[model samples]
Target: MEQLLLNVVTLVTFDGAVNWTVGFLTTVAIFAILALALNIQWSVGILNFGVAAFFMVGAYVSAVLTLPAPEGLESYVAGWGLPIPVGWLFAMVAGAVLAILLGIPTLRLRDDFLAIATIGVAAILRSIANSVEGLVNRSRGLNGVDGFLEDQVQGGDYRWVELAIALVVLLAVYWLVSRATASPWGRTLRAIRDNEDTAKASGKNTVKFRMGAFMLGAMLMGLAGAIYAHRSGTISPLTFSDLLGTFFVWTMLIVGGSGNHRGALLGAVVVGFFWFGTPLIQESLPDWLGSRVFQVRQLLIGLLIVVFLLWRPQGLLAERDRVSRFVTRGPDDRTRGGDQGSVWERLRSAVSR
Candidate 1:
């Protein structure tokens, strides 16, 4: 056992392996941001879906705005000519704006209906990205965008710099999310998640709160998109496909503990390792099993999700407290006098009666 552990550690420490490790860490940091965004919606606002649309919008907007002018288009949509940081800001703002537009129509719907609506929105966005030639280059994707590390460093060693920057961004986001989840605004979001009507009765403006959470979550997703675009040094519409990207983010959030930011981050790191690392190991296996193991890895992931739902739906770092206070009473228990009162008023009267 000791020798096996030593071999694993040695492999991780090797110079050739460092780049892959850094790439994995970068993926974890990016998805950690995405998980946190979904947590704001699903865990804090009780909105289960729509993260995919926000994520796609962020990626597309950032890629388009920052992409260098194509050969003939210099006269038309000449690139914004802004620095990468400015481009990132634009990406985040665009995401927030789109979120408001998307949220207004669907926020009033119940859980499953909202999910379906949001999924439709994501599909529509992808289709538009694929079809809009002038805008996104029609599935060819946006290329030649200024990379975060472009022209700034030599080969081989530059990944370290990228890794360092990613770490800084991750830490900054971690601090911001930690503070936000403890703020009054965050508490209101949690209240809405637990029971929207109850939150409104307590004088919280539910619509306003929901919009705020949606926008904030969208902004974080946009930041993640910006990092992703720059990290790859290229952006493609296909990168935002609804399957693995969206499901992986959801899986990370679920595995980490939905309402907890720390859990979200940890879940991203844990799942990301398995998501990418297993394939590397499979590549080295004997010929008989190595070829088919990639398929098996995906099957294992699906099975894991099913098992988790069955045994620990709350997830690894489940929220310690029940944050919602809405009560459901049967018709037999609803007295005529209580029917005349608002939800809050009825609760008060029930206590006093």
Candidate 2:
């Protein structure tokens, strides 16, 4: 027993454990941002399938904007070597612009049709990135992309610094998203999502509201991509695969529960565990099983999705009930368990008015 304990302690150094943890949390932060962005789109009832494409655009745009000038034999264009924040800002702009261009033509289509169009868009983007040798460095991808504050931080400590920065970005995005979603504009969006006909009858322009939501969601997705690129320090067409970029994110949202921002964050952390955990335990399994561990991990994820959909479709966290902000509270409101009756009465009274 003493020998086994000593061996385990020697194998798992404190620094190694901390670095691994930081890397894992950073990935979760990225996923949380993506999930939140997707939640916005889902709230507006848009079935966007081109999320990977938007992510690729943001990565490449940020890479190009911030990269140093290419040397001999480098085929990619535009390495302006700008600051990282500039890259992040323009990545968002590119995403929103792409959304507008795509949304304008296809937003009016039915959900299924829109989904197909978006899939095609992702494929087209992938093909362009692959074939355009003069731009984005073709399949070779852009390398040596700058890290956030790399100049200021060095050595093993940089991982912790980057993780902190990633968390800060995640929190900022969460704050902005949560604030936006709780406002009247957000309520209108939810109203449109839940019942478009009723929202239309209420004199809301459903199409415009949907377009706005889509743009906002895409912008956040772009920001996520930028953060990912800077963190990883390299990117390629392969990095933006539909499976990794699209499917996994959708799974996170579905599992966490759609329409709830907190659910989105929870789902990201949960999915990130399985997605990143498989490799760690692979060595402990039989050789054949270890070799196919990724397949097993994917199968497990599929099973989880099926289970959640059939039994708990609302997800681990269901969307919260929305109450009117104008509802007044009694003096004992803080002590009350929850004034369900009065809350409903206020809602009814407000609706009647």
Candidate 3:
């Protein structure tokens, strides 16, 4: 009897650990997607502060589309009961549309003005979502939202499958953005970012390039929002707060590496560690500190941003040098220093030296 009880306890603990890990990783992948979206826009010098607006739009859109028509005590616009993929697709379209609509006017503004405009847009959207009772059921929000593969899988096993889905989507977006950044178009975008007047002097349409980057980033944020909605099984106005939706993602991009996609992924993981891990540590904190858990999390995150900005603002992974394979010469071609191997190898060699 004693042995059996011990075995049962161990099994339960192990199961809890697995569930926690799966949840953490799924959250990280979602944030990575958001961070990548920001990286895409920021790479081309579009200062988008309305990430939360697009994210909220995606979640509400997906939830409304997938959910069945409200029965009683539940009211919202358009519960189409569509398939999840269809919801995801339309969410991306909605986000892109919103981006283009806003970008047309705001993209021409200076950096500070653009940020202020985007943030104001986010605030407007949040108010609309919160005050409009007919839309998204207002403060109550849409609940009973289905998880990815929830009908096919049950219990903790479902989380693993969801995590797999999130990771797959994350990798697909990563590959897409990485390829885009390595192309001639990406080169032009970066040139515009580094110096808009110079890029314009070189005959590039700066506005067009910036608009493209803005829409693409918004679409990715929409996708991430859809994934997040499904994972949480619910989303409310509070979920898309400026801190969680906007500032946190900005920090991820800044800490990861603004211009580099890999930096975005790394920053997501690092910030995610603190974002999710703090709740666990809160239990050990003194009563005064433990009571203000939310504030404590914000403090830690703010402190992290400050420390990184003061010391290593380029982030843990700096952006790679943008060079065309067809135009730029490698070490061997330039000075016969054998092969420098891949980009990673060169970075490692430089760091070691």
- For residues 1-353, write the lDDT of model 2, one tens digit per residue: 00101122223788656666777888889889989999999998999877898887888899899999988777788899999999999999999998998898888878777788778888998889889878888888888998989888876577777788889999999999999998888999999988999999999988899999999999999999999899888788888888778878888998887888987898898898878866776668899999998798878888878877887676666564655656566445644322435434533432353
Clashing pairs in 2: none
Q: Write the per-residue lDDT of candidate 1 for residues 1-353, one digit (tens) a residue.
A: 01101123335557647656766676777778888878877755545455667776776666666666666642214366567777688779977997887778877666566677777777888888778657667677676666666677887677777677778887887788778877888888888877878998999878787778778888888888887777676566677766556777887887766787766887788787777776667647888788887677678777767766776676665454533335333343343331333444533453454
Clashes of each: 0, 0, 0
**Superposed Cα RMSD, model 3:** 5.6
* lDDT digits (tens) for residues 299-336 of candidate 3: 87888788778876767666645445564555345343
lDDT of each: 0.70, 0.82, 0.82
The TM-scores of all predictions, comma-separated, are: 0.82, 0.88, 0.88
Candidate 2 C-alpha error for residue 308, in Å: 1.3
Alpha-carbon shift of residue 168 in model 3 (angstroms): 0.6
lDDT of 2 at 152: 88
Worst 10 residues of 1 by lDDT: 1-10
